[model samples]
Target: MSDFMTRVLRRETHSPRSGWSVVAAILVALAAIYALLESVLAALGQPAWLVHPLDALTWIADLPGPYPQILLGAAGFLMALVGLIFLGNGLLPGRRPRHVIDNPRVAIVVDDEVIASALAKCARVAAGVTREQVMVVVSARLVQVNVRPTSGIRLSEQKIQAAVESQLADMELDPRPAVTVKLASSGVIGV
Candidate 1:
């Protein structure tokens, strides 16, 4: 089962987009901009002066009657449609189910140089994980750094978690901290 899952998860190394996709994306972006400008003008009860001047210039070309407005409107609409299609494709929901980890908790029992360094850095910046609050315990090859916050700031939880995770990821650590927030006082936490 593990081998089968590994085979299913493996991906081929290749660039994702083709040249045509890039061209299509550019066309779509132009259309979306046109639509947005048109909508804004309509909302503000203002005439589309920018488009009007262009239309006036095209009108002097002496093309078939009413052809200028038709051509310009069609072009704008086509561009907007293409942009919508591209956006829809990019933002559409995925079919695959995400992998959820049951036990994300980290138990550091040993004081290795790498782990200790990470913990110290996390403790220093973390409002919750003070020097005294951090407890380093070791058991065989495992090392756990238990952090307890002295302040009841909620922002500390997210900040400390992100900091610790980012630091560990930078060091190429396999498992990151599963930060648990414990409040010491009640108050509004700023992000």
Candidate 2:
């Protein structure tokens, strides 16, 4: 692939994974600052800011029998869980809720909300219903359209489905999403 295509594909599909790292860094910095403050207070013969380091170490060492064992086990488990969470976030690709529009010259990515809104509009027009009567959800693999017909009026499911499908075709979305249209059992009074 060309450089332009590669850049566009990377920018559109994936989000930055540095958020967790930033949070971890901030926590570590805060802990370091607290430790420094405690050390300074101890050296000056002043009361410790929190627990003195020596006292904390002595308490851990003096803890009796099964109590220490249980505490250590729980601490280990908590650390392992935190490590796994960070590892998973770092390793997995952060994909956005977006669809790609393929063009020979340039890449275009559209947010799912934009696609849903467009399909909702199409369904509303096809069903002859107001905006509130139609709800559309566009996801990576599916476009679901739910419509409530105007009370006392009949609606055609096939017609609405066809309109939505036609609109999807016009969008030329890459990895085309499946379309499903459902009419609600009860209708709202027509506005």
| Top of the candidates by lDDT | 2
Residue 110 deviation, candidate 1, in Å? 11
Leading candidate by TM-score: 2
Please give the CA lDDT of all the candidate structures: 0.50, 0.89
TM per candidate comes to 0.28, 0.75
Give the alpha carbon lDDT tens digit for every residue of 64-174 in model 2.
645767877898899999999989889987778898887777778899999999999999999999999999998778999999888899999999999999999999998
* Alpha carbon lDDT at 132, candidate 2: 93
lDDT by residue (tens digit), candidate 1, 167-189: 55554432233434343444433
Taking every candidate in turn, the Cα RMSD to the unseen true structure, in Å, is 15.9, 3.7
The deviation in Å at residue 143 for candidate 1 is 7.9
Pairs of residues at least 3 apart in sequence or in different chains that clash in candidate 2: none
**lDDT value for candidate 1?**
0.50
